[model samples]
Target: MKKSLFSKVLFVCLIIPSVLTQAAEVNVYSYRQPFLVEPLFNVFTEKTGVKVNVVFAKKGMAERLAREGQHSPADILLTTDISRLVELHDKDLLQAVDSETLEKAVPEKFQSKDNTWYGLTMRVRNIYSSKRLGQVDLSYEDLADPKYKGRVCTRSGKHPYNVALVSSMIAAHGEEKTLTWLENLKKNLARKPQGSDRGQVQAIHQNLCDLSLGNSYYFGNMLNDEKQKVWADAVNINFPNQANRGAHVNISGVAMAKHAPNAKNALALMEFLVSEQAQQMYAETNMEYPVREGVAVSALVSSWGQFKADELSLETIAQHRKAAIKLLDKAQFDL
Candidate 1:
């Protein structure tokens, strides 16, 4: 009986460590597309020996996390746009992180003041005008001018991208001025606000409009596709507000879940992402500017001349989001 008991105890001991190793994994709820982030995670796994498990969704991961509450299995949340990141933080779904590596890598302006989130990449909001338009220089304010009436194309004002831009306008100007600007911009739309940023580019190609607003990376993505390359070729990217506060910019960022079960692995992955090697891979793969200083942008991205990014803190811009949305509705922007 004693011999049998010893063998069973030995088996249990062997199984337990393997189970613990498997449990060392980090779980990610990501709004970013899988292709954009999987390569970085693979490298993280190879370096740290801690596995990454990602669940991707196009939307509502934040709500899902909130619903999951303290019992949530999510260790980290990866998403694009400052709006979504701020939304997660505002919902109390994210926890503050204290990582010296992240602090050193990311700029103060690009990270949460409370350290709940950090930006991974920078994407400029640029105006794409038909090459036929011939060297038109414009600012965000100029979009509302009567001269450009009926020449603008954009995605829905309700989209997080547009909302963030509108929020910035509210920050630079104010509620009343922003509201008036929205009304004028609404009048300037060639058609009802519709489509993705790429779709707006397509509109410019079709001569439906002479100008559109889009993130810089979408142009790079389009250039990679044979069919879409023609649309990309048709427009010249213009960095708006070069003379003033600088062009509006946004980020793709990540946060830790408030009740992360694998906090150590999650923090490790977060730190790894901001490291020089990972930032380079991130910039090259996504065709975005790395948030970490001195990590070079992709060669293709470099071909586009650099312009000053707006210096406004994202937290200040986030505060105006509600006001921006209200202004959009009041202007009947999407309607």
Candidate 2:
């Protein structure tokens, strides 16, 4: 009986360590689509043997995290757009990270001042003009030119992407000038601002409009789709503001949760994401430019030719978000 009891205790002791090891996991609350992030998590798990649990939602991640407070199981928050990152940081939902790997990989302009978040990839706001239009070079300022009146196509001005762009405009040119630009841009729209970025591309292909504003990646995505390839082929990507402030660029970024349950594993994942292998995968799989210096972009993205990106700090741009939204409303852009 004594021998049997000793064996049972030993068995329980061995199982405890196994269970503890298996519990080493990092949970992610993400605003990015699942397919875009799942593969990276799978790779991270393969290399580190730490499991990853993800909860993806189209929006409201910050609200959810705020509601969860200290009891939240989330270890990381991955999302696109500096505005969203700033929103969470402002709400104190994220914790500052001290990773040299992240600091070294991300540029000063693309990272938080407090090291609360790091940009993972970049996507430029480019002008897509119909091939027949003969407008090879364009500027964001020129989009409002009277000559182009009744020719521009765009999504809703209230869309996050456009708000960010307008925010950058407010950063470069102040609120009054940005407001004027918005009014003129609204006057120039081909129709009531409606549809996705790709829809603008489709409008351009159908000759419904002469030009549209869209992110660089959508061009690549459209080209990869059979039906959309024609729309993609119909327009030439013109990097706006190349001769002046440079094209406005936005980022997809990551931040550590304020009450991370697996902080160590989260840090490991953050470091791994900025590594060369992961940066390259980000470029290839998402068609976004890698935030890490020296990482090559996908061949397709590279073929689009290089142009200077706006040097404005994203934090500064984010600060103008409220003003941008107000200007959009004043301009009645969606009307």
Best by TM-score: 1
Give per-residue CA lDDT, model 1, range 305-333, as digits (tens).
88998999888899999999999999888
RMSD of each: 2.6, 3.1
Q: How many clashes show up per model?
A: 0, 0
lDDT of 2 by residue, 23-60 (tens): 67899988887767888999999998899999988889
Which residue pairs clash in candidate 2? none
Model 2 lDDT at residue 246: 96
Q: After the best TM-score superposition of candidate 2, give how far the Cα of residue 271 lies from its true spot, in angstroms.
A: 0.8
Residue ranges of candidate 1 with Cα displaced over 4 Å: 1-19
Top candidate (lDDT):
1
lDDT score, candidate 1: 0.92
Model 2 C-alpha RMSD to native? 3.1
